[model samples]
Target chain A: MTDNGPCPLQRDAPGQVLSLWWASTGQETAMTTSGRTGDEQAARAERLPQRPVRPLHLQAGALALVLLGGTLGTAAREGLTLVVPEVGGFPIALSCINLVGALLLGVLLESLARRGPDTGPRRSLRLLLGTGLMGGFTSYSALSLATQQLLADGTVGRALAFALLSVVLGVLFAFAGVLLASRRRAGGAR
Target chain B: MSVAVFILLSLAGGVGAVARFVLDGLVRSRVSSAMPWGTILINISGSLLLGLVTGMLGAQLLTPELQLVLGAGFLGGYTTSSTASVETVRLLQQRRMVLALGNLLGTLVVGSAAATLGLVLGAAL
Candidate 1:
């Protein structure tokens, strides 16, 4: 149900569309149409999700640690090896990571679309684990490296333009995934 | 020790990431309107840092993995365009069209320039 009061996030300016992000009795926290109510406008702050059973939490932490260490360590070693001036200025290690991240993000999203949320908790877990952690690990480092390599190889226009576009559009695609996921979740809640 | 290196890099990455987070918070708090000074500042500064590191590494000056751990790993994570894009979407959803457009345009225009500048200056140094 849409509230008629002004949104808490908005200013006193009239007709200002103040969209309040609130988590209520119902899950998927409805984005209330902007308005305000007395004594009830502190913006819904959801408590952090409870960590799983102790064993699960430990497992998650362990997994996270391993993933973080492994990815970073490999990148560092790769970077060290690629520091030659003859190569691109930026380390090639990051290029490898970046490419991995981009490809994984694409694949994960595609897979999620197919799986299609068997449950809310399951869906959320997938997002938090698969998207946040995994997406973070994989990066456009490879593409960046390729761009640098191309530039070094005297393909200036292609390298610079491609690099610029990749950074620009890579960001847009990530945001798009977030948007698409949220919309899908919201639509399912209906 | 390899362990020492790991601890050091992780600590640096953590501090840099947190700093980026705090700056974003400050930006959001100060400018309720269209300006995303937080991200703009972070990205630009990060680019410069990358440039500085790149220049050194390119010159075979920086020690191995020093640039990777600090520059690529730390700074790359520190600077984010995804957050900016999401904030832009939030502005648009809240019907802040002008703000959204301004944020998008400003970040791209300013960010690229900053990165380019960083490369040039770092190379010079």
Candidate 2:
């Protein structure tokens, strides 16, 4: 039941046209080809107008926001440093934060995925808080900390294995999160 | 770290994330092939920058400000596993699991390997 009219998909920039050439028989040669010029011109080429003073505004806003987030993360770390002893002899307190964040993100994602996805608050929470904030906060820096500790204890093999496993498992757990979320939705649909 | 240093890191991170968003948007606007080249490119580039930063810092060529600019700012903006994961789920729901899996595993494998490479180069320096 599909008609053969050119599927008019909206281009990003206004006043742009896109027409795909499927037939070499010349039946649909009326569009896309530059009528006046023999050159097979590009189907679409229209630049979106740059916003006046947009870069300046964006630069300022971005600087402010990054400063806010970085300071918050850094201050939190500083406070934690005052509260807790050195983490695995690294003296960096945020190492613990990253580890704890990763674990919590994993667990929370699991629980939310179990709830069966219907685009609820839980799903959004898992997506935003668990995946975005937690994943962002938890750095590979912490994993290196643990690995360093293992090696420091004269367990080179353990350190190597830990290095390999933490990375491999981190990805696997992330994929597992996707699977769980999808399955939950499928279950609900059924 | 002083408040100034803290502000610098945050400022850098914000700019980085926004840059990532803009880059992805620019790419996606043209290529709707469902391949997500933007994510891949951003991540790989981020890893490389991270490597460069690590090497420089280890070599004493970079100060804390440079670290914040590149490590906390640029790489932070360049890489995004969370959005990639969420997008994968959305794709899976729409029965596009192959790309999803590729993205998930690809970022992890590549990102980790890149980090290790960076680490080695850093240590060497």
Candidate 3:
């Protein structure tokens, strides 16, 4: 990539985009209240972090990796669903897919970040794992729909249990992944 | 799921991920907010579509293969829980309690609501 330290554009920086918007809006309000004119406001905006202008090649490479990874992850999920399917109106297959994917993602990100500065190979790897594989593997939408369906069917207890478990397991697994990676790193260093 | 179905699911998933990436970027470019509207929109719409597909399949208005392709494959790739969870953690770290809570609660509540609406509509059809 362009070597801007792990390429924020490539990383799952959705939160970054949101926060940026909020910061800019707040800044604009401050500027307006301070009697700064349009020119002054523009000058202030110039100092903020401008969006990275990624080159065509890097963009294309990332896109290709994402597509490849997404295909694999989705197919894998489908395979699992085939074997497990839903039982008792509960989507055991989806739950397993999401939880496992979340754990893997945590490990992937932790290991990748610890490897070194996010540059050529590292960036590509992150794209393949974070954006492509995990992105495809763990689905928020399906989980929501499945939970909602249970709710619709008056299975309130089951819906709540599934939802709570997903969130709790997701966070805990991610933490475990980070811990495991750190331990590996420490051992390697020693 | 058959071999052909698996292949189709893979293709659909690739398309779905690309669609998510494109739509997220488009929203980010067009709108500025602390709320992460891009992801929110993506998750909500994906949930609705998945719910509809699930409903249709359940009602036998659609086939199982279609459900595998659309609901499990496309929607699965399109909406992401890992990223959402990580974002929530990041917000918490930044001490943006309101926004963090909003992101978490909003996604759950609104996404579930959208799915419910979709299910109702699909069942009605």
Candidate 4:
């Protein structure tokens, strides 16, 4: 038996050692192939050997955490809407809420990835905060509806601007968050 | 909002989030694509539903409070901008500029169209 291959002990081992090994080797293979093709990452990821399916109980636990986190996040968003005050009929509150959520999600995901692979506490936090809280806090439906309303109201220019700005700025903000986290890690390392 | 309505809204939001999570997972498992198709589908569908609700509100078929709960609370949680934005950024980081731009623009364009269709259909009803 090759000692380098995944073993039972390694599979059950605690902490980031197993994940690091998988990331360095397994993910490198996927990344390299996908990097070459650019569009085949997901297909390659699926074709690659996968980890064992998680137990049902663990999956349920994740769902429960998402539910709890989503509730709190939605409430927070609602509370903010009550006080955020719109500007001249523009959906400023909605835009700010979405931008902030996107920024925070970028920060949270990058920091967690830096900390370690997605497992144990890290996985829990990702589902709860990243998927659940931030997901709930931001509203794409509202953005779409607001744009539609603007167009219907004959302000086609404003409608187009709103839609474009929201999508473009949102992506930019997320990138900024990723840079912020990575820089923090670099500073800490130094 | 009243305390009761607030609680209901929050609960609805939780349900919507769970629905999004489940639907996304189901789609992801079935389809392997570099683009975040799951989020795109979710956002478009949620936008459609919200638009329908809005039309209903305009037609006086749904109460304002009910619209608040369903539109702002449920559909709001169901459709996520943050994930969509982050996924686009990730694509850009991977140097898939075309896919990144596609994901960003595609979602907005298709989602807006879906919302408009829903609104028209709902108003016609």
Candidate 5:
């Protein structure tokens, strides 16, 4: 690679260097492109694996998927809230939603992990379910608000119980989901 | 909520989730922390906004429709307990006890404070 003489563009932006590499090497280079900003570039370089830049169309498609999933998730949450009355200011509905969302998220992740790092459909599915649906369904703000109200109403015990229960149950349900997925996988294998 | 309100709520939720994704991605891309600063920031900010909305609603400065759109829809989607819980557990699993405790306790402490502050500001207005 050094025999090609000083690749001045190498020190230039990785994106620019990539274009130059294409011009010179006439083949796709393995070197990764840097992010648009310097800080992002450093962070990206540290965590992300070297890969070709994604096309704009693909990114837009993923965004659309996430939006659709989010809408459904939020609608479900609101619908539940409307039906479930808060007893003594305890947000039973919100806690149930969070636990269920965590469980589903765990299941999604476990199943996706089996397929490994993905492109196209699998990646899109991950974003739609994990980032959009579950994120929308399980709300931190509502939990915070409920807890705040409980405290304000002088029910510190209930508030503390609600907070601790939400965190503990959310994690436990997620772990249970993962275990369920793994058990199913094992059964399928047998 | 009416059908129209539900529709608006759904649309707002979509926007909020997209905002969360974009904002979280932006923060994660900039910060190199194992503590999940992105989720923590998003949760705290969302809590503050929700508090403001609640205060405004209590003051009767805003309609229920607006509250549904901005509060139950947008903030509800933007702030995620599931991610926070999962991330904290992940940190614990990785043996980063300090980070795990920080994420769990920090989010709750800051979120509550921010919400209360927003409520006060909203009520003042």
Candidate 6:
């Protein structure tokens, strides 16, 4: 995410990704105005130098939005866990939740970037949905605990496989989401 | 779970998310690495705490409902898998294979280690 003012950290590396959940929002402004090709814009947005640095500041409104979105996201995750029976204690529900969250976050961020600069409503939605909702919905700690439990239960193979597969699949799913959104943008432009 | 407990769990999740936001901001403000140190720290810490909570639950130090509120709600909200995954993909897209792999594998390995340590500590307690 981008910040409100120029952040020295934002200017650290040329293509460094900006903002985690708690950081400032709105750094991907270059892609929309560069007049570059769509693919280039997308690539640059993901890789090249970002827009001006913005200092990370605490915003009550953004925090509140994140809080609200997080409540909904946590409720949804809890509800799903209640219904999705564990498959032989493999935590299929958690894997599903994390994978789905990764994909949706990819889609949301890409679509929002393509739509416009990360400011105003775009920033708000990113904070609410991307940082708050998706961040709350997916869990790495639970995955770690589950893996540890499996190892403790003497299921070494299952433990390793579960962890490896989930991480690998999560990256793939996120990439798939980016492609899905990019394709849609292209189709719409044509 | 009772409706009150459920609502409390959800609110706890909200608070946890806010906590994550604040901590990440604090770390990001100080660190200027290409890697997302903020998220990496948050995940490791949250995993450790979750492991401790799980051990405590096993030892009957905490009730099941309280466990749910803290484990599934608080830690789950605080430690984010999506951000980690998306950040990895973004790094890979940029062809920073070393950093990408480091971010991916480092989190998994360190986070698991932290969880193990927490479990041990909790059980000892």
The parts of candidate 5 lying over 4 Å away from their true place are: A1-58, A186-190
Best by lDDT: 6
lDDT of 1 by residue, B36-60 (tens): 6776677667766665676677777
- Show pairs that collide, candidate 6: A1-A19, A2-A24, A2-A25, A2-A26, A5-A54, A5-A55, A6-A53, A6-A54, A7-A53, A7-A54
Question: Of the pair 1 and 4, which is ahead by lDDT?
Answer: 4
Residue B53 Cα positional deviation in candidate 3, in Å, after optimal superposition: 2.7
TM-score for chain B of all predictions: 0.77, 0.85, 0.93, 0.96, 0.96, 0.95
Docking class of 5: medium
Per-residue alpha-carbon lDDT of model 5 for A1-190, expressed as tens digits?
2333335565344435324524352233333344366786577666545666554223555567568778888999999988998876787899899999988887777766654554433456667788889988889998888888888999889888988788778878887777776676555545
Give candidate 2 misplaced runs (Cα > 4 Å): A1-190, B117-125
Error of 5 at A29 (Å): 18
RMSD in order of candidates: 13.0, 13.5, 10.7, 10.0, 11.6, 9.9
**TM-score for candidate 4, residues paired by index:** 0.82
The alpha-carbon interface RMSD of model 6 comes to 1.0
For model 2 the local lDDT of residue A50 reads 33
Per-residue alpha-carbon lDDT of candidate 5 for residues B1-125, written as tens digits (9 for 90 to 100): 68999988987888788888888877877788888988999999999999999999888888989987999999988888888877876787799988888888888878988888878877878
DockQ of each: 0.09, 0.14, 0.47, 0.61, 0.59, 0.66
Could you give candidate 4's per-residue lDDT for residues A77-116 as a string of tens digits? 8888888887866889899999999999999999889867
Candidate 2, residues B1-125: lDDT per residue as tens digits?
56676656545544455555556656776688776778677766677567667667878878967776567544653355445544555555668878867865676556656665665677576
lDDT value, residue A190 of candidate 4: 56
Fnat scores for every prediction: 0.02, 0.07, 0.65, 0.75, 0.71, 0.74
Tell me the spans in candidate 6 whose CA falls farther than 4 Å from its real position: A1-57
Q: Which portions of model 1 show Cα errors greater than 4 Å?
A: A1-156, B1-7, B91-109
* lDDT, model 3, position B42: 88
> What DockQ does candidate 1 have relative to the true complex?
0.09
Ranking by DockQ: 6, 4, 5, 3, 2, 1
TM-score of each: 0.51, 0.50, 0.75, 0.82, 0.80, 0.82
